[model samples]
Target: MPLDTNRLEPVLPWLKFRGPDDRGIWSDRHIQLGHTRLAILDLSPLGHQPMSFQDGRYWITFNGEIYNYLELRAELVQAGYQFTSKSDTEVLLAAYAHWGTGCLEKLRGMFAFAIWDRKINQLFLARDRFGEKPLYYWIDQGTFYFASELKALLALLPHTPELDPIAVDLYFHYQYVPEPLTPLQGVRKLPAAHFMTLQLDSWKVDLSQYWSLAQIQPLEGNISELIRAELERAIDLSLRSDVPVGIALSGGLDSGTIVALAAPKYKKVLHAFSVGYPGSPPCDEREQARSLANQLGLPFHDVELHTEALVEFFPELMKALDDPIADIAAYGHFAVMRLAAEQGIKVMLSGVGGDELFWGYDWMIEAHHMTQQKQRQNSISAIATTLGKLAHIPIYEKFAVTPKLPKPVRSLLVQGLNAHLIDNEHPNQFVFYNLRQDFRSPWYHRRSLYSQEFLTQLPERNPFHPSVGNDAAWSDITTHLCQVLFNTWLVSNCLALGDRTSMASSLEVRLPLLDYKLAETVIGLQKQYPNEFRNKKAWLKQAVQDILPAEILNRPKRGFEPPYASWIQALLDRYKDSVVSGSLVQSSFLNRNYLVKLFQKPYNNYALVYRVLVLDTWLQNIR
Candidate 1:
């Protein structure tokens, strides 16, 4: 049971890009902690991690910027606490020493850190409110191991971890594995807004939640003013860094809002970075971004992502992601960060959470109304509606449904076309809303695409209910849907992509809109004015209208999107062999015949094809 220093060596190599500034390891009787520091707040040796406090009663290794540390330090000082260094790491230790786990409530900005309480012989770990940072942990044969990246954790494990069947099934359905479950058997991610404690004496672990979107209640005030004030404050705090900060500018309102509010307040010349395609295709936003930068008088830098570059780096991008997520926007995210890194920018601000926080996506509202209509149906009405859909499908199929209609739209039309469909009010009903078209279909439908062997391997339970629990009230369906989006797509897909791609370049990306306080204000405002949210970012636009240019404000919303149709075809052409006889088929997780057909006409079934390719490519790369 003695601590093994050698076990920590392999992980550092895998995570060196995330924290290249410094490296340290600390160990005692049965404990060893390792850290590689990026050194954003304090670049001195005093800011090194595996940092200790109170003559070593508490030692800590932290990742992420505590933007509000200065404010917290003053409060801690008033409570008779003192610090040796100006680093947030010291303030974090002192905060924990004084407040225990209560310290999580007082801290702001993104973070994932652990405190080793030598006095109690206990170890404590916590992730930020929105999971802006990553933490993966595994337990085996009485040993607990954790790291910032899954590959790092894999290197530290005693043996090779097997692919988790349930995780694979969920990944196929959701395009990414939801939290508390990773792709490997026996390995899990710590959920966001949560903390854990492990006592060395008994080796017992306790996990608890510190925050939830559901905890926010409706606020009463000038809603626009409240939101504007919170946003400015959040951006102001985000700009508090010793290193140079840049903005991930885009053509849309979200990034424009950040630039409008942040450029003036930034202490030095604020740089703007953007990514576009070679042809200046309609999807490219570089021109808009360049115009904005010119108007603001900020230096602008942009990169063109040729298809060849994306194809060449596809495998490395998959590996850098560390988790097999099928999102195509990752290429853009990686390019922008790499551009920023090249400019010597250590930290960047992004506008990621706007769509999820406000009612930005119009389809979200449609999904909410559709669920309500289904809930209000009586058996007779349900039967009539089901039959109407069935009757129209043949007629619509003959004339309307083309071979290239995109499988998602087809799946959406055919979803819930089975018996006992009236009882679809379960949280699983919202799966289609989040782009998981075939997740909750009847067994007959699943059997067509997934192999019987794979179907049998899956447990007889709803995969989504674990993450999207049915505890929230269905009456407030919109809020419930928003919460589900946050828990599922927003965290696993959007935030995960941001953290992984940015950190791959060893740069820190901060999302001011995702600040917990700003999120709470928006959610609370939604509760008070539910009708206002249905109008799609009405309050958000109003709050930032004065600062945002009218053209930028009114421009349609298309976030850092790539030309998916072309990119997917290019990826398919490059990795088609994987789909024809790849990991999913060879392992009997997907039916070979179905996969062959899907691959034959990739356009029709691009979603499923993309997921299969990503998984197969990932399995191959890791091996």
Candidate 2:
């Protein structure tokens, strides 16, 4: 029943890169804690983890930065609290000492930390609002386990845990395991903006949320000015690091906005890093990135990846991302972080949350418009809408569109009819309005990829609902859509990919746009002016128009994507055997014959095949 120091051995090496500066362990009668230090602030022996305060009544092991630590520290000092070291870790402990769980609302940066309070004989855990940091925990035989990465958590288990079929189902449907669920049975990721407390005396665990984006009240101001001021302030706070910081630049507005504001304010020269392909494909944005870097008088660096390099890093990339994200663009993130690490830049800034917050995705916009039309239709008009679709039905082929409408538009119209008129489901949900005949739609609706046994294993739960109560008061449909994007795609895919890929090299990536305050402001702005989003990020463009280059402001949103055709074909050629006899088939979760047929025509089934291949490699690596 006593705490065991020996158990830490298995998970230590897996956590080495995440915190390579130092290692520390602490234990008492009931709980054991371990931490490996990255040492971003107060880089001295005083900054050691499992740090004690108030005569060892409170012991803490922490990860991530508190950008507003100085301000919080000054306020606590006024309240008769003192600190020995200038690290954010100490300030965090003091903040808890002063405010208890309410302290999470006061902190304004990314974090996932646990504090042991001997007075109450309890352990407390919390993650950041937007989930820029990672936290995973499991409980077995009355003992609780937690770590920043899934593999590290897996390493500490008594045995290799059973594969969670529900998690696997979500992965194939959503492309990543949604939080509060992992691929291993009995393990969970603490949902973001929430906290957990464990009481040893009674063995009781309680979880509660402290923040919700859907509930923020609208702020009053000229929307553009409010956004610009808050964005500038967020970037300024994110620059409060002792280590050298740089920006991951690209040809798009999101990264460009970061480079424009952050480069000038960063005390030292803020370098920009990017990734490109060998032949300068359309997806490559190195030239645009270099041009912006030149205009700003900042040094620019980029890595060129060939199909061979991508194929080589494919397995390693899956290992880097603890969850199977099914995103081929992950290599671009990993490549940029690796390049920055090589240049001795420990901290890098990324532009991850901008697109989701600003309605940048054309699909999201179209969904909103389609829903708006549905809301306005009466019974007769609804019938007329069906008739109109029928009028154009003859001209369109099976899953093909005419030349008059753009491809995206035609797809939207067809799916809109199916969702409302034909299928008669999901009248108000955009998450179900998928763009492709692939994994983008929910698992319940898909039939081609999943086997009958796997389908039977899935629970009758709506995966598209936000983890937070769906009935919470949202200002408008746009707000509802944004919240869904935040919960599903933004947290699960974009932020997860950014955090893991960057942390693979022990580098910290800060997304200033994801600052909770900025998020609340944007949510409020959306409520105050719902029509502004019809123009796709018009408020954001106006906010940074003067600071950014004219060309950068008006450019299209070609995100950091790969040359999919060549890359997928090459990857299929190299890792084909994985699907034929890999973990998916070995576990009886996939139909092997169906996968084999799909594998033969890689180009047609690229997205679904890419997902399955990643899952195969990930399962092998995990085992």
Candidate 3:
């Protein structure tokens, strides 16, 4: 059966890729719609997605790289599987024909693909472990609609799902609504490392997990040597692309390491890109990146984002994002990728997964101490109450009283002091447990939004099990840090932002650090090499010590920081009447007073500005 022309047209408009220039969707009239993509690998027309195999018994629309395709292709070749072209797409189809659902277990890369097994009369959708790629689906009126982006799925449905206010609340708190829930009520993001198979006739979906980080065996070897070997292997695999590839270098350890690894592998000098605002504290690292690039004998391109450029790109940037996220750094990422795209770099590597792979965040250490201190006695609440009386003293003064304690003990004392300050803070009288404080929307006050039953059920659904035992600091690295990185930072900041920003520029960005096998291997040996993650990627630094320069190796982790607040201020000042008087804040969904307060106090409030700006832009365009 040929695909329906009408249904295919709608999917074409949603495509963000530009390489090879084939954009079309395939819909089997009443049954299915398949979208074809042209990624970095397999540039031939035969390698295009929606590839049919087994005499048209199977069809697949795949996204992402399969690093182990060569190995899988070898095994399938021996199993009498013939290929038309050197493509992972054909390899995937043939592998699925031979192994069925078991083929998902054999895949070792970041991917989100949908395979319609015509013989089985079922459609299978799967996402990579750690959700490095995205797959969104919505069911409506006995019809199944799926896409790499929620907007495409929405386009297929007859009507959009009502805005999920609870999800909005979660967005303000976590900057992103975690899996199983989306901004729209009826849509859902497929969980990572899991697959969903739907019966065509009945339209019934069954989901199952194919892989888990918890299942990996702890590697017993010299930790530094193992890290070096695994990281090199992963980097080499990710660099397999026909088009010219570049690295998104932040003078940080992760990107620096990537540049050092990739520079020697490619035939020509690798192009490196970075983004920053002039005179900004975060922008100080651009010189360091340039110096490293010079030493590596590569061309360094710095995308200097001004307030004017940010304002110019703000509206489109908002529309490019899948959801209204408060990740301010995303602006800088998008700008750099846009510049990279203009420079004709099709594929680029990012330092996204490094922080999560290693215990590189302050919160990871803080959470470890908090989990341990809670066990000493549930005295946090009492200590917080006592510290409330010392509100007259500065926070450092309060901390001074608790000096001479162990590292963990000191962390707990700091936590207690901070909690006390929040509990007894001045002005708004709002108490905040999390760093984010903009979740005080009127919608949050609704009984249905935060039901007691939902709260009670949340503990069970908590991704990291409390009983997993965080007795050792290494447990923090393996469990809490890994969970936070995967479930929060990587999902929200790295992958989500990377996909949107890169795709917005029609560039494919890859993360070797987020490799599933590499993550699993690192997590398993976390406890064995406790000191490695202590100073955040200490082991990774040691492993690449020889390859990377001393300056690059010892450089502090400065994340991609965009000048959103400054940009917003400038925009508001320049186009104050248009923005404020426009439908953005005037919409009933958001409070005008709160929006005004946001502009009044924009320091460290880039999230607030981003959320409001994106929401405003979305509302203006969509409504």
**Candidate 3 clash figure, as a count:** 0
Query: What residue pairs are clashing in model 3?
Result: none
TM-score of each: 0.93, 0.92, 0.85
| Candidate 3 lDDT tens digits, 1-623 | 34345774665577645223565455553555556465677787878767889888888888887888989999999999899898888988888889988998888787888888777688888998878778888876666778887777777777767666556556555666767678777888898888998897777779998876656666677777877888888888988888888889888899988888888888755799987677756545688878888888999898777787767776777778776666667778887898888888888899888877776876555555544444343333766656433422334433444655576756655555555534422222222223222432212222332334334423222211212333342334345446644765578556887888888787888898887667776777775555544547787888888978787777677867555556667766654445454554353345455455555644345554555555556556544
| Each candidate structure's count of clashing pairs | 0, 0, 0
Off by over 4 Å in 1: 378-382, 385-445, 462-472
Model 2 misplaced stretches (Cα beyond 4 Å): 377-398, 402-416, 419-437, 440-448, 460-475, 533-535
Better of 1 and 3 by lDDT: 1
Model 1 clashing residue pairs (backbone):
none
Task: Give the CA lDDT, 0 to 100, for residue 316 in model 3.
Answer: 78
Cα displacement (angstroms), candidate 2, residue 13, comes to 1.1
Model 1, 446-536: lDDT tens digits are 5766888878888887543333435364556667777778877888889999999999999999999999899889888878887666456
Give the TM-score comparing model 1 with the true structure, all chains together: 0.93
